[model samples]
Every structure is written in C-alpha cells, then in structure tokens.
Target: MTDCDFLVVGHGLAGATLAYVLRQRGYRVLVFDPGQADSASNVAAGLINPVAGKRFALTWNANELLPAAASFYRELEQCFGQQFFFEAPIFKIFGSLDEQSALLTRSPDHPWGDYVASLATTDPGLPGVQAPLGGAWLRHGGHVLVRELLAALAAQGEREGWLWRETFDWTKLVTDPTGARYAGRVQARHVICCEGAAATQNPYFNWLPLTPNQGEVLDVECAGLSSAQVLNRGAYVVPVGGGRFRVGATYRWPPFADGPTETARQELSGRLAAITEQPFAVVGQRAGVRPAVRDRKPLLGPHPTVPSLSFGGGYGSKGVLLAPRLAGLLADWLEGKAELWPEVDLRRYAALYRPAAGS
Candidate 1:
C-alpha cells in the first residue's frame, strides 16, 4: 500500500501551505491534486491588503495574520530561488469626498492606526490612473505569484515523493477508528480536505457552507502607464512590469458562465475607465470562483463523525494572508502539538449537524 502520515486532498493555497509545513516538520505527506479547471487560487491576484473594501475596514485578524504570511513567503522566496513574493505598498484611491473625509477621521489614534502607514491628499501621478482625490499608502501590502509558488511547491513535493496527480473518489475512501485507506493503494493516519471551492462536492464535508464567488480578471499591456504599487478603488490595477498589468475582477454568485463573460468585461472596463483617464487595450481575460465562507472565516478542523477526516479551506480572497499561519496551526494540531483555533474550529457549526432542537 502507498503509505504516508497524512493524505492531503487538493493543492490550492490552503492545502499547499499545510503540506509544505508538514513536510518541513519532518512528517510524511502525500497530496492528491487533480488540478481542477476552475482553481481560484491559480487566477487570484494574491493581494494581501490588511484593510479593504469601500468601508476600508481592517480584515478580521490582520494584525497577526499579515506579518506571519509575509515571513512565510519571504522564506519561501529564498527556498524556491524565485522572485514570487513582492512586498510593496498598495495605493487605495479615494473615490469621493465622503471617502476622503471618512479616512481623514481615521487618524493614527483610531483602531486602524497601526495598519495605516501614510495618508496623502496629493495626486499619485500614476500615468494611466486618474487621481483627482488622491489616496492612502497601505504599508506592507503586496501580492504573491500564487500560481508560480504552488508550482514550485508541487515540484519540491514531487522530488520528496509526496506529490500525486489524480482525482480522489470518495467512495474509495475507507476509514476506521485508526485512519483511512484510499483507492486501495494509499493509507494515512488522517485525510485533510483543502478542496477550496470544490469542497461542495465532498460527500463528507459538503455540509459546511461554501458559497462560490465568481471573479474575472484581465491581462492587458499598456506601454505608457507606470506604477509599482497596487491601485484599489472598486477594482484594482496591478502592474506586472514590461508595460503589462493584471486587472478586472467581478464577483457574482451561481456563476452562470464557466468562463469569462462579456458583461464582466464591460464592467471591468468601466472600472478601468473610472481609475484611469488614459487609453489602454485589454489583451486577455480569465475567470475563476472563490470559496467565500458564510462566516467570512476559514473552515477548519475534523468531521464531527469521522475521526480520520478534517478540512482546511474557505479562505475566499484573503487566502494569501490567512493560509500561512493557519497552515502551521493545522500542522501543529494534527501532530497533537496544539489545539485548533476556536473561531475557525468546525465545532462552531455543530448545530447544523444536529436535529431540530425539539425533534
């Protein structure tokens, strides 16, 4: 039988990070990654902004999550010998007078004090971007090349005899009090499902709420536009150097079309126009679905019934920030070195698995 300490399903950021940490800690790991078509992490912009959205509220756990994620990626860059982690500032352009006024009230003494690096009322002067109202420089905000990093991690796992390329069939997953045996060939002490949005298909953990967020992005080349920082308004324009940029992301539910749609393209084009006054051409466009959790936090821990099974997914757009620290925590918990964080623990959803209160 193909044996290992853990059997991790799915290789998206969540699973990948967990596998990486487990491997580092001297645990044997075997990963089953089908490399599905709509893998959201592959198309993600990987933006790690501590504060986001129109309200400019700080992410739930930004203070501790951001620095931990950054440290992981920085070390990953050195380990992989690639320049995938880019630590740069994100310029959040103020949309109107209301937004500027709100930010003005959010001085250094506010709850968001430490996250705000600097606030400016002067024009940013990004060539293609229009900046009449100016913006704020969010310190330590940056993007990671998620697709490339996953590839590098997979290659390393392969060399270490832990990477497998195949889709897991749930019917073949045989479990008992001790562990699980899959496909009649693989055995492990525990099986963790990090399927991202695709966990909805898992017969065991599909009960957890995992709403799909369809997003579309564009890859365009603009010769004259110059900028190093990520621009966020309603949409974001990330400079990929060589006069090319990655832009456009529309969120929708029950995603009608599996691929890019003309409607989203027009919407993004409108956002581009609103962000920039200069002329630019859209070169390419792609779309993927994010697993936006119902509670706006990751779904972590084991199945209520199956001792050998657990889950780690539902990161949504904040995977870049949430994955690293959570991965370590999951590894520690799985190895019996620590307890699962209460907030993300699957036990919170215990009511769902129970029958009606009086019944």
Candidate 2:
C-alpha cells in the first residue's frame, strides 16, 4: 500500500488548490479525480468580482479574500512558469437610470470606494456595448483560467507521483480512528472530500446542506468587441483572447435539469443582446453544477464524528476567489497551527449529522 498524508477526493478547484497547499508544506498528498469535463471548476468563468448582486454590496470579506487570491495565483504562476490569472477591470453596466442614481448616491467615502476604479454617467465608448446608462469600472477583479490551472496542478502532482486519474470508490474506502485506506492500495493519515456538487452524494458529507445549482455559459466570437475588460449587465461577456468571448451564466436551482438546454441558450443570448449591439456567433455551450450551501459559505473542517475525515467544498460561484486562501487556512488547521474560521467551520452544522443506524 502507498502511504500518504492526505488522500483528496476530487480534483476540482477546491481539491487542486488544497492539495497544492498541503504538498507545498511537505505533506505526502494523493489526489483522485476522474476528470469530469462538466465539473464546476472546468466550466466556471473563474470571475473574481468584489461586488455582487443588484444592490452592488461588497462581497463577503472581499478586502481579505481578494488580495490573498491574487497572491496565491501569482505564486502558482511563478512556480509553473505559466500565466493562468488575468487581472482585468469589470464594466458593470447600469440597468436603468434608477440603478445609476443609486450607485452615484453612495458617497466617495463608502466602503466600496476602494474597489471602484471609475464611474461613468454616459456611454463609455466600447466598440458595440449598449451601456447608455454607463457603468462602474471595478478594480481588483479579473478571471482565472480555471481548467488550465487545474490541469497544470494535476500534471505537477502526477510528476511527483501523488495524483491518480480514477474515481474514488466509497465501497473500497475503510476509515477508522487512525485514518483512511482506499481500495487496499493507498493509506492516508487523513481524507478530505473536495467533491464539488457531487458532495451531496457523499455518504460522509451528505448531511451537510449542500445544494447543487446548475449554471450554463456560451462561447461566442465577437469581432467587434475588445478583449480589454469584462462586460457585465444581467450576465457577463468575458473576452478570452482572439475575437472569442465567454458569455453567460444562467442559474437553475434544483429539481435540477441535466446538460445544456435550449431554454438557457435563449436566455443567455437575450442577455447578450441587451449588453451589446455586436453581432456574435455562438461557438459552444457548457454547463456545470455549483456546490452551493444553505448559508452560502464554504464548508470546511472535519466531520463531527469522523475526525480524520474532512471536507472542503461548497464554494459555489466564488470558488476561484475563495479556494486559495481557504485552502491555506484548512492546511493551518490540519497542522494544528490555528483554528478553522467559525463561519466556515463544519461544526456550524454539526447538529445536522446523525450517525447511521448501528454504525
């Protein structure tokens, strides 16, 4: 049997970043993932926005999380000799005059001042965007090439002999007071489930209020649009080099539908039309389910009863920005260097875990 310090199940953003953090700290880490193409990390736009929703409220803990994520991605870029993170400004178009007035009403001394790079009251001249009410130029926001980053991390892990391209079979996993053994081939000092939306299916973590949310996006070729910044209204249009842009993100809550749908395509296309007058061709469509939680906070820390087994998911749409920093904290907690932040600690929901009958 191969011995390791951590056996991480799933190689999505949460798993990949956590494993990288743990391995960097000199732990023997093994990662298992079947490489689902539709996994949230693979399909996510990897947007790092500090402000959210129609109210334009600052994202939860943006001041701390944003900078940490930027630094973390930069460190990875230095290590891999590849650029995966792109720092770009987000042009948030105002939906109406009321919306524009509301944003302007916030004083310059408002907490959001730090993130506001600029504000416009008239059409900000972009090639074909239809922002007559103008928009806000949000700084310290951008996108990460999530799929490429995960692949790079997986390659490095493989070269170091710690990543496996296979599904983690629950039937073959044996957990006890000491640790966890998998398929009789690998024994780990601790096991962490970073499975994204699939965590709802994990017997160990199923009790957690993990709600799977389906989201879809479209890849389009818009020759008229510039790739300098991301354009957002109800949906977003993210430039991905050349004349190609990724548009979308239609959210579908449970009683979940499967795969890309014609309805979603029309919805996104309509939003795209509202954002720009530029004619674009739909090149591709992709969909994935986000691992959301009841409280909308990430799930971290060990299982209430099974102390050696832990979880690190429920990042939902903010995985790209939240994962890196939270991974470090999880590592610190695992190493007994610190405590898990209360908001994210799984103990917040410990009352939900009821042991199986006669287990």
Which pairs of residues clash in candidate 2, taking residues 3 or more apart in a chain or in different chains?
none
Q: Give the Å error, residue 307, model 2.
A: 1.6
- For residues 1-359, what per-residue lDDT tens digits would candidate 1 score against the true structure? 98888999989999999998998888889999976655898888788888898888888878889899999998899998898878878889988988898888876457675777788787867777787888888887888888899989888877877888888898799999899999889989999999888888888877888887888898877777666788888998888778787885789889358689899889988888888777788998888889888888888898888899999988998898999999999988898899988888877887776432452
Against the hidden reference, what TM-scores do the models get? 0.95, 0.98
Residue 15 Cα positional deviation in candidate 1, in Å, after optimal superposition: 0.6
TM-score attained by model 1: 0.95
Task: Name model 1 segments beyond 4 Å from true.
Answer: 354-359
Model 2 clashes, total count: 0
RMSD score of candidate 2 (Å):
1.1
RMSD of each: 2.5, 1.1
lDDT of 2 by residue, 58-174 (tens): 999898899999999999999989999999999999999999998888846576958988889999888888999899999999999998998898888778778888888876889
